[model samples]
Target: MKTQTAKEIADNLYTGVVSRFGCPRVLLSDRGQPFMSKIVKAMCEILQVTQHHTTSYHPNTNGTVERQNHTLAQSLRTYCNDTHDKWPSLIPGIMMAFRRSVCATTGFSPFYMLFGQEMKIPFDIALEPKDSLPQDTRVYIDQFLSNIKMSHKIALQNEAAQKEKDKVRHDQTARVRTFAIGDLVLLKVHKFPKGQSRKLCDKATGPYRIEEIGPNYTYGIRRISDHKKQASLVNATNLQPYIRPDPTRQRLSQEDQNIPPDPDSDSDSDPEVDQDDEVTPNVDVEATQQPTPTPQQTPDPATRYQIQKVLRGRRKHGRREMYIKWLDGSCTWEPDTCFDQEMSDFINSRWTKQGKRRKSYFN
Candidate 1:
């Protein structure tokens, strides 16, 4: 298509489908603006076509089309390397070549699969005699039907076998990771815009809290600092756990260090003597030696609590409650509303739209 406008996309879609094979029962596409636009939606609705979108940013859901596009692009680049401006004109010839070639997975050319016979090219016409057509029309029709049926059956079996092999190969190196609602994770950054150095840019950016666990290993994540949710659901492949630092260990280490004695005071010095020549007041020595009781410091309501991890979450009386493990070695079942703004954002990110609650634990 010349332009990606909704009108252009809708026109192309109508011409491509309705003019040829008629409206399909279902239309599956990515979450592109043109595919999701009102025009295309209205068109589908009028035709009674069920439209479905692949998971955002996950191309494997629509892998077949994606693979076809990749093959087409490679073919175009090879044929149109010197004639860049005329690449569009070369598409028909490239597509014909692709359709006539035998596919590894199906063990049949697309042309043969569609028409129940091999497509005759210029080379075949020049080197071989043309086969005579069947004299009986009924015989020809029956033979053609049988050939197509057998081809389709074998193709399906071959496709399934290829898929099994692909799955086995994929599983050999695949690492599975899962995140629960309220777990902090770093989102992988995939795009670096023009004029930006990819090496200088961060590989991932987040400390985003998972709000919902979705189908196909996707997670709804929101930034912890800004409380802004990601526009698209992030795939598990692009996420890594964000391990929060332990404040208790740091505090303990600080307490364990010994403080050097003051240089100005000596242990052998008299207890009542004044350093500046002023006489000390007459008071009970034991009372003077007694250590004053230090008041316990209360936690500030405005302070953002360092969450070590979220242990469990649940919806209680229309409000979300979380069992949080704090960095200070304290665990509490606090209502979502009790947290400050940033903490509240983190808590809110863990709840799904359906309000289903699950227990999340650290690995």
Candidate 2:
């Protein structure tokens, strides 16, 4: 989207001195907005500078300038530790630092290459100012440039060494044993039931087969259930190698089968018994037994009265609750204000029951 016009890029590259220092014959840039602007194109034509542009959105074609921008930003960030937004104000410092520094690829400072002699600055001055001898500004400039060149060379060497060290470490491979489908494996069960713990050895309790490698990447493994026909999935970390079952042991049914049945001949004899015969004489038909009639008692009226009394007691208490609610809060009952005797007794009983239950729980 940023179309840099040849004139605009040239203007920024040279700052305010492009026309004063003599215009470049050919200006190479990208099809950014500043370059594609009609005004910039007209300006380039008027200045009689040839304009060249690379493919759209290809920063590598204008790599040198983009790399310079990146360096300036990085250096600017380092200088503006507390006030990074003020980086624009420090653009002059960044540009001077860049120019004074030697080029990594070409091994020459831009200032030295452009002027055929380097520019002088405050950082590299060594000798005191003199008046007797004719002052040579060129010596001061050379010393300043020489210091920057040494620093740049050292930085490049350190970068190359760090890259080599990283490459050596990064190239090493991590070991992994890939599990495939239908392979018998012992499941490394990491989690278990709430009351159960997994302190089993690496030789843990399984000879399960891999039902599936993975359904998707989120779940990495599939294991067949030991007690069912179903399968379960697991991650790589939860898996372990299968251990052989114990050879010296047998199932409970097998052990029971090895035992012999008890002998059936060991039995006790029955007890001895005696018997006798008895006779009875016949009776007359006229002597027959008579049936006795019993009287049934009627229900008592006092029982009915007791039932009505119980009902009357409950009704009286109900009226008292309603009267208390109206007197205290206009018939809207609340815990704080409705304090009838019946209600207080009921509340106290319930609190007592609740307290007993709480104590039972703790006990």
Candidate 3:
């Protein structure tokens, strides 16, 4: 009796058991409130259809539909095997692509059966119409039916192979760590000037004192702004340790003018020991001399900044257009424009190992 979204109800009608899927002269669903709702009943009415909520408590009668659900779910799982490990993020795209592609089920795709045409998928560039007539099509209908059966067998085998491979990969990477509470950590700020997220220059934006942590998946961060204590709990996937410009960080940048070259020439070289001893909370708050930031050749943007959304979250799946302000106790981040594609590629080309990098729509 659970209520469903309009999207959910429409999906049921489009791909559900009733949609097996000749157009319904009479529609049949359960006595669920969603189907009983005025909008839903109105749709059936508009189609000149009959709505039959099955006779109360007659569970045996709905076996055909229930069995179809299991069969369909299995088919769907086979169709979307998440082979690239990115299918979850690309679910909408994948579904959209699959729905519009040719299928073996009815000698055409679901799109074709419902809409009377198979849509040309984006990747099929060689698709061209042949000079075959619908009158000729009836002559070859039996061959088309035979082809559908063969295609289904081939697809099921491919899908099962893909699913097994995915299972193996999942088993292999089972140890990928999930974030837990009370761990000190660092977050990479999406701090790109002109909305560019590819800048390696923006990586170490925080030693952001982790304040409180969440149950197995998130952490709360607090940036020091004196009296204004601002905090946000972000997922652990978005965080990495703010490695504060380690000179020995395997690959050194061209920007080594900030810290002088390592001098093995001098002994008792314990700058770290000195700095560690001096970084007590009382000393930071109560001392006269402010701690000098680690020097770099290029003047970087001020690190501790507040970001604000210019757009509302309800639109576009909870992503917001944002502006960040620098917190060097000086206003620094210039936020006027969106840096879409060109700047991100420019930053990526700087990487020593410039493999393919995914461009997030959020960026």
Candidate 4:
């Protein structure tokens, strides 16, 4: 086929998809030129099909279709010559092979599930006995319908069992994260083009506030810095809880800068009160000396950085340093002295926002 324009795409969709399969309730696709064109939009509006586009960077939303396309391409490569221009001629044979193959989820071939009978392959017709007798018309019709019902029942049971297995495997390593209205979240950013170095690129943008929760685990996000405009719907996979920077750390850092030199220890020393100093009335010395709670240690609403991955066993100048990736956008190496036990474990845990099944545990 030649390069298709907007009108051609719409016309082909109406003839090949709508006419054949009837109107779809919803259409999900990437933001390709054909899908985004005005002609396609008008066709969808007229057909009453809700259109949804996946986010720019996250291609997993349409993973199933991508996988099928990969399968079709592989089949084509096996059937076509080196030139490959005539591969479209073999589409019918490829589709027939696919329809006859049993799916893992349904545990039935697409042709058998739809038509309630095995397709008559060329070999079946060529190798059949010439003297085979045929059954009565009424009896054949009744028997065919009975077999269809049985196949449908088996398909349903297989589908249910597959769903259960997937759920159990997913939940084993899943990290469940729930967001309430008014909660702050960091949106993962994808501005860099393909083939660019992403090692130091900013992975996320915004300490955005959750304006609304939409269906299908999508969250409506708006920038905290700019609340006037609402951004696109973000999937849970691309979002992570934001942990705000701790003020106490800054305060302690400042105090460390002003403290006088400790000639004995050769390291920074805590300020000490002289024995001759008089204690003030109504003031508890022990209470004043207690350490302030950090943002990570408390259930603070202003949390911005949630540690998701930890690269342990790293060293800086022969001292141990841990590299951590946060939910928002930080990937940095830090000394062990900087984090407490709780924070370290949280970083080490390979948690994701969507709670998807990971191969390490699921496999």
Candidate No. with top lDDT: 1
Off by over 4 Å in 1: 81-83, 126-134, 192-196, 249-363
**Candidate 2 lDDT by residue in tens digits, 248-355:** 342346444454422321111212322132213324211221121122333332232221111111122122211122212233323312454434443344334222
Q: Write the per-residue lDDT of candidate 3 for residues 184-216, one digit (tens) a residue.
A: 456655546775557545564545556666644
Alpha-carbon shift of residue 170 in model 1 (angstroms): 0.5
Instruction: Assess every candidate by TM-score.
Output: 0.66, 0.34, 0.25, 0.66
lDDT scores in order: 0.78, 0.50, 0.50, 0.72
Q: Rank the candidates by lDDT, best first.
A: 1, 4, 2, 3
State each model's C-alpha RMSD to the native: 14.5, 31.0, 20.8, 10.8
Least well predicted 10-residue stretch by lDDT in candidate 1: 286-295
How would you encode candidate 1's per-residue C-alpha lDDT over 1-363 as one tens digit per residue? 778899998888889878887888999999999898999999999999999888766798899899999999999888885748999889999998999999999989999998999998888889997668658889889999999999999999999999999998887556668988899999888888789999999998979999988888988999999999988777898899897886643432434444443443332156665646754554543244334322344443223466677777666655567777887889988876576655565445655533443334332
Q: Please list all clashing residue pairs in model 1, or write none if there are none.
A: 211-349
User: Lowest-lDDT window of 10 residues in candidate 3?
Assistant: 308-317
- In candidate 4, stretches whose alpha carbon ends up further than 4 angstroms from where it belongs are 1-5, 31-33, 36-38, 48-63, 76-90, 131-135, 193-196, 228-231, 251-258, 261-342, 345-363
Compared with the true structure, what per-residue lDDT tens digits does model 4 show for residues 1-363?
367777887888889989998999999988788889988998999999999998655677798798999999999988899887899889999998899898998888988887888888999889977866877999988988988899999989999999899888877555546687888888787677688788777888789888888766778888889675354677777888897887754434555445553344311243575546665543344344334322233442113345555544454444456565666767887665577655544433533323322223211
Report residue 77 deviation for candidate 3 (angstroms).
30
